[model samples]
Target: MEPDNAERDPLPKTPDPLADWLEEPGSTAPGRSSWLPILAIVVCVALLSGAAYALVKLRKHPAPGSGLTAGQTALASPGSAWARDFPVSTKADLDGVCRGWYYPQSPAATGPAPHPITVTVLDNAFKMRLQPLSVHVPDGVKKQFRDAWQPADLAKVQIVACVDLVGSGKPLGKCSFTSPKVTTVPFVEGIYQITAYEVATGRKLTEARVIGAEECPLVALVPADDVLHSEVSDRQLYDKLHALVER
Candidate 1:
């Protein structure tokens, strides 16, 4: 036992780095460590990586109701809500509107009308039996479509013709070829598909389709005339067929 009057020596203190740091200026109590900034940086990097991955995914798939597919871009007109220019590059691109057997253009065949083309409408509804409408394939329109492809010897080729539907499969009631009665449908509408094939080999050269609601949807099959009044829908339909030579 030490005497009351004797002085006691202080024990040697162990170094406490954490306690020293906590007691530094600007520190109130033990809180987050100095490494907290590094942790925050790691979190930010992870968030940025996730955002970049999402952007790539969005580019791969288009949003629904955008009137477009993954690779397709829409060419919209100012006042025409129902009309759009569709450019198809592959059979897959044309698959939605073209249902019947389709083939790629013949490798040897550069021009669609290297041979004579026969056009026909293939609607078999009972209503058509009473008033069958003829599909007139005008030489002028044919030349326009054929001109889009590489010119070939028009004198050398011969091909067979096949018929396809345009829009709704319903019978097209009487529509005036001179004055068309264009209408809109809430539910069902008519669509027409015009396909061309090589008569000898039955090879599909090209095809296109159009859609509209009209009492006489067959008006689209009629020949275009300068004196004939035309509707926007009818013109759009004709334009589609005229552009068929495009790959």
Candidate 2:
């Protein structure tokens, strides 16, 4: 009889909507949204992407003193070759062959067979002169010397003679010269041999000759050689000579 009261009214039981939704497979739950998980995934992906980009940027532009960007150092030439081995004899030797002088001991497999010749230039006194045989001089470069000599300081100057050789292993021929009024001369197109002479005596400043060769045909006005040896251009030969001189 007492138990019948239970069935009279289960004291106004409240329906739990969240519990009901959870029980249903497809129903949405309270305070639980699908967008939160989607947003979290998107945020994680963005963070990873940002980190990847940072690593790439750091690799491209590294800090200074980093050995990664450093270049190679130059070494001294072996003193076996004639040009590199022989000490410049005199000022006259420097003037005649120091500028636009080239000689290869072995024939280049790529360019034409070099036209070996002996080059010599005598001073006004004719007492001192440059004697460098087997030196190389481009065909059209002689004109550069002529044009350059037309100026006030170089007008009276004379190239005298030039020698060219095929392959010398190292640099070309050794040169010498004598000019009282000459400080620098455009021997071959863009190639210039600067001679710092004593202001009063008009002699060369440093006995250490400075030889510079340029292979820029368009800019230097030096022409390429089409000899019977190889296809090696004057530019290539010039570059080789430049490398040797710089060293």
Candidate 3:
């Protein structure tokens, strides 16, 4: 009796419901949802899609020379060619004619030599360089020259002669002077020898003359007489000299 009941095996104690649910392969608890794995998968896919879109956009807008965009190619071609084609000249002509010679005004007056003058022709103007001889051509004188030259703007004239005795070969105690005697003159539009003389002895080494006009602005000195004369169109000469000097 008591024996039989004890033998019945105290009714197999039922496992805890929560423990059974946890142990089961498939089970849904009160506050738990079954969509966690699916949500995780969706999040992963969304991240991957964003990453792929960014990569595609980056490929389309890559840096220059990346070989993908045409911008780099366009910049490389004609721009480079144009730079290669046109150049500038730096070294000026410095021959004896280009570099001036000296003459004595008075046969009795003896000295080393007068200042060596140089002239440069630019597209819009000409420059005169007189060294070793100091000629204080007053602003009034310059203005007079400009007026005489006529129809040219005198204000733009830039005269820059300095006294560098060490460089001068003249015996007149070496005084250097630079004067932008005239500017914007129709006659002086290009390179020309306006005047060459020794103020010390009043000797004239070269005469004043213009070789080129505004229509054609290139001047080259005649080898024999040092006379100014037009050689070619300024643009053509500029292009040629630009190429040569640039090289």
Count of backbone clashes for each model?
12, 32, 8
lDDT tens digits, residue span 1-247, model 2: 3555755755787866456435565565555663566789999999999998975553231123322221110111222112211222343433433342211111111223121212243322233544433334345654433232222322122222222222312233222223443222223221222222211111222221123343322221112331111122334333333221211
Per-prediction TM-score: 0.28, 0.18, 0.17
Q: Which portions of model 3 miss their true places by more than 4 Å?
A: 1-25, 29-31, 61-247
lDDT of 3 by residue, 90-110 (tens): 122111112221111112112
Better model by TM-score, 2 or 3? 2
Each model's lDDT comes to: 0.37, 0.30, 0.29
Question: How far in Å is the alpha carbon of 45 misplaced in model 2?
Answer: 1.1
Greater-lDDT candidate between 1 and 3: 1
Index of the highest-TM-score prediction: 1
Q: Rate residue 150 of model 1 by lDDT.
A: 23
For candidate 1, the TM-score is 0.28
User: Which digits, one per residue and each the tens of the lDDT, describe model 1 over residues 1-247?
Assistant: 7567457677789967586346666573445465665689999999999998975553332233333342232212222111112222332322212222211221223444333332334434421311112233345655544543322432222322333443354443343444454533223345555565432223455665555433334444432221111121434434544333332
lDDT of 2 at 27: 68
